[model samples]
Target chain A: MTMHPDVAVLARYADGDPGLDEASVWSVESHLETCADCRARLAGQIPDDTRALLDVVGAAVGRGIEAGPAPARRRMAIRRRRLAVTPAPWLTMTAGVLGCAVLLHAIAPDLPSLVLLLAPVAPLPGVAASWNRRTDPAWELVAGTPSAGLGMLLRRTTAVLAVVIPLLALAGARTGAPLAMLLTPCLAFTAASIALGSLIGVRRAAAGLGTVWSVAVVAPSLATAQLPVVLTPGGAAAWAAAAVGMAGFAAARADLFRRLNSAD
Target chain B: MRTISAAETAPATYAWAVHAEQLKVRAGRHLAVDGLDLRLRTGVHGLLGPNGAGKTTLMRALATVLKTAGGELTLLGEPVSGRGDLRRVRRELGYLPQDFGFYPRFTVREFVEYMAWLKEMPKASIPAAAQRAVERVGLTAKADAKMKTLSGGMVRRAGIAQAIVNDPQVLLLDEPTVGLDPEQRLDFRELLADIGVDSCVLVSTHLVEDVVAACTDVVLVNEGKLVFQGSPEALMAHGEQGDPGFSPAERGYSALLRRHRGGAA
Candidate 1:
């Protein structure tokens, strides 16, 4: 309170003139932050037209905030909303697909890693649909939202994987594949798809990675009736490292989804 | 090129809800909105254009759905070129795309409330705001009905409800009245007039009557360029001469496009 800005300086700030130096403006703003009197004086200097517009907007927003249902009820409603839109149908179908893999392993006990092959790929389709704007009916609305970036996509992907992963674990238990073989490679592929999906769309990334896995590992393993090096215990550590690395890569490119084209 | 710092309480000269300068937008490889300049204040501004004239693309750019190919665009005083700025602008903006989509399983109320949340509305304020918006669109009775059960017109109304649920500072609706009946269209017009009192509302449509009835101003675009921007009277003035359309407004619209195309040729 020892010193105050000049009236002329306050007036210049009020009018939005470009003549005021940035340093002086910053000093005045910093001073005003601690000075209620200056703040009031500055508010008084706002143009009548702008003040009126602000008043109208303020009233509308005030009414909006004051209104609405009770918070507890709203929280419950939001929970129900999340439950309703959680892509349960697709997850259920994925479980059915996993069930088929389990049945295939039981029928051909000697078949080369039937469940192991299916386990890694089972979550791909569901994970792909979980975040792909094209597959979701509400994609237009969801994609345009402020939360439409990688955070939202990761949330949906996790939800899809949550359902599919456990099913894969159960399938591996039936097929006699090592737990490390089923879980690590499955997570690795999911993370890799998302990492690549950050550049291309998730659907294309899933399809491409799925095709590569089928050709590189699944096809070779079946032909030779021997476990691939990458699917063995030693490869588990590599898969674990890849999952962390790919997830980190996906997080770094989060902004890519924000500006993604609608068709993507 | 005036700059208003975040800390300054200065009143800007433009005071526009949306401002674009030589903005270029693309749909795939083709330029949709090419070198377009537009400024809108607080009012219902109707956007009139033919198919592929870039109205949707312009709307999408404004809504932050599509990236600008070139030039500058601002919404609610925030430049949309930056990710942070676009996120802040989107919080205060509402948009209903032409092909508005929704989850079939979500009830009407849940859908609107979810949109409010996505727009970052306060959790407590969401239910009432959503209820009011639903009631405004005459969907109070069906608030709890799943989205898939609603007919086409009802679905469109639901779309409108979500757009206005947050009482956004800038509301953009693309072909909002497409499936609405005559009576419903009238109701929608009245809603536009009511909301236009404070917020900047832009409606993009092929229908001229809606523009004449609700919009304070009309912008006509063709071939990704603005043909005219003025009052409906000025537009109708152009059609005063021997014209072939049914209504004066329609004739005016047709005449303006023909004149622009002729000039381009």
Candidate 2:
């Protein structure tokens, strides 16, 4: 039968006295883990001030939850980051549209390039949904938050791109379409949407741009059965310039998101 | 006469966390908060007004959700007119709009933690702070439940929990007691008093008794103007015998509204 440590030895252990032998310290700590009676006795040995100090330390430890994130917490944080960035139906729309274009390409060879025609407008719904008051529902609260300005907008836009770009790559591969035709136009449209979003609301700008692209460009190319000038290989530079310029303009006019009218 | 130096007057000038002078904010085309001058320091201040009295607009402006249309407004000693000051000011600000929306899929704890993240709280402390906030609003049991599953009152408490999660310097709640039950309202008042100790909390509501019970000061507004601002005791003193309200404070509110309209006309 195991014997309990003497009260005098327990008191010294509680004090963390240097005189207390090392073997005794380890044995007491290990025993206390399994023995509730010994723990209570040791607690009785601690002075009030010492107990108070220990309590403070314990509380502070509780409050931090992480000085350094554990592996499980890191996994949870990565999941949370994904959820926080894209917690809406926008991604579904982006991917679905691309899939439809791919299927339509296989089903209708006479249509020439449904995949190419729709590429420019593919990310519009996504970019719009990222910060729109209607879709997010937390618009007013998010607008009033510290990270609500251009940085947050860009972060969400980038997340949308992160999801949409890969979908575009897959769509391009599936349709035997040129990668540049699929990518640069969508990037251009996304940038233009954000640029004009600062002037109007994001949702409004996206809707307007998508309609304009369909009417002014997509419809004409479809009717003529020839690729539009902008969709041609040589037109990629203009698309790239348009992308950069619009992005710069959007950054410069970042204040628009802060206004009540343009908050969406 | 000696002129007051900038250094000497600075203490008085910086005392207010929210200061507005001739501030104007338009809701759509109409000027909702027009030519209003107000100042608030630490402690709870209840904003009482009629439905179209621009109370929500005023709260929206103080929360930095609406830009100032025409005058000077400062928050935490920073002017609202400049874009540079917004991030700094917003870090110390918390707001609950009259009608707020959430992701619905987020759990109570996750929502509060998300709000803390939006406010840029230290990453390590978010979990503890969110837990504490959920407890403070008495939603510990529902902490893991999805927001869509919560009752209206529980959702309101969750909103309160998120507002306090960051321990902001200036807190704004518009019509916060609308959906809370009687008992929950009492608990919310206690929570407000607790938060108001170190932060400037502005609560805009139509419930006069709540103002009387929980507020250190009462502010009355009409047609985008400050009609009255004083202690609850002082507001009760303004009450006349036959005013059209159930309690002394409500009656005082009615009398003041009448007096203001009469004076304006």
Candidate 3:
């Protein structure tokens, strides 16, 4: 049997006195947790002010426990919130642009395959989304992390492709654009942006590519109402080779992504 | 491997967790941090300077967000110029920007954990580490609250929480007390002392008193140049009755800045 705390010690403990020492206080508290009689005796020894404070705190805690969410439910809530994070908004925006392109092509089949013209740059937004310091609020924090290098960029870029490719394929199917032409150009532009992005930054690279593509391909195609030679099977093959070349170039210069102040 | 932790690698004055010599960093075309030499060890260091003095730029350079345009920069005994060394150094570094952004929808716990993951902490240890960090910042109750729901001070605390989530060896915080109330700033001082036991903490702020109260040493910079480096008491020593400030530290700060400006002029 353990010895109970003496009357004097119980009184000192109830007063919240530090003179009792941490060891003595710890022992008394541990004993009181298991010994109801000690608690009962200590309850009488507790100062009235302290007792009132305890009642208020205990009541508040009890009420809080009753009203608060269950641990399981809270976990589920966090899981749901995590889904809407990172690249989803960018992915959705890209999807919207593709949708517009598909609708435009359907309304005006003579207007030179908008889907085909725009497919190459479809993944650019999402690919560049996570890397931009200006647009991304968490850029500084993310940049400080160890894994925030070329590997992370590639993973995010791949995720963008996973969502975009399917959407591009759907748009192509609707607009009657060939799969090779639609998908190949998409790969070429994404690779080129990332390659050039290694030097200028991903967001800038994407924007530059998008602008040039619109000027050289989309705008001209719209003006003349004719799909350029770049939209052909031979052109698609050329884009594929360019995709491989640009990807290789990006890989060779992976060292650039590891540096700071590249305006990332 | 045993000898790698030896104290001899660094110069006699403390182990330099962050060391910069003649370092130049660019902010666009401007050289914000120019030819500055500084050494930091395992203690809370207060970085003090006037506006545009390059305190934030220096902090950014230390955080490795900006490349050193020239000179030498070493973190935890390794030169920061190497490619492979960056990842290892980054894992040991923590930074809170002057004005940070958060994913509004993420809960405080989620954000910290995400940062831990980004720092590449082991999967199993992330949750516990993140929780400990949140608790340290006194945000246990608000751990589940979304970032957008937090007040400004709470957001600042959340930023500090994420910065310390990995228990970084080199923690850089710029203007951390900008939004904090007096009481919260007091808590932050205690947290800084606790963390500074083994880590090198560099806190940049306009609040001179906060520096004098919490920091082991004061570093005053002007125009990308290091003007002063010494103990807080030494900083107070520079102040005279005529110097402008409410407290000794503030007067000392004014005196140092005045002297530096006078010299430059």
* Top model number, DockQ: 2
lDDT of 1 by residue, B1-265 (tens): 1233463354544578899989999988999999998999989999999888999999988888888899998887778855563566777788899997788878999889988988887776787888899999999999999999999999999999999987777999999999899999999999999999878999999989889988999999998888899988888888965777789999999999988989999
TM-score of the second chain, each candidate in turn, equals: 0.94, 0.94, 0.94
lDDT of 2 by residue, A1-264 (tens): 246888888989887799998998888787888888998888889988899999999989987886757566332662245445543577887788789889988987777688889989988888888787767778888889887877787888887888888888898898888898888899999989989988888889999999999999989988988878788888888888899999999888988776557758
Candidate 3 residue B1 Cα shift, in angstroms, is 27
Mind giving the per-residue lDDT tens digits that candidate 3 earns over A117-141?
Answer: 8888889888777567765678777
lDDT of each: 0.83, 0.86, 0.86
In model 2, which regions exceed 4 Å deviation?
A1-75, A78-88, B1-13
Q: Stretches of candidate 3 above 4 Å error?
A: A1-90, B1-14, B82-84
TM-score of chain A of each: 0.67, 0.70, 0.67
Residue A209 displacement (Å), model 2: 1.1
Candidate 3 to truth, TM: 0.81
Query: What TM-score do all the candidates reach, one by one?
Result: 0.81, 0.83, 0.81
**Winner by TM-score:** 2
CA shift at B124, candidate 2, in angstroms?
0.5
Classified by CAPRI criteria, candidate 1 counts as acceptable
Q: What is the DockQ of candidate 2?
A: 0.46
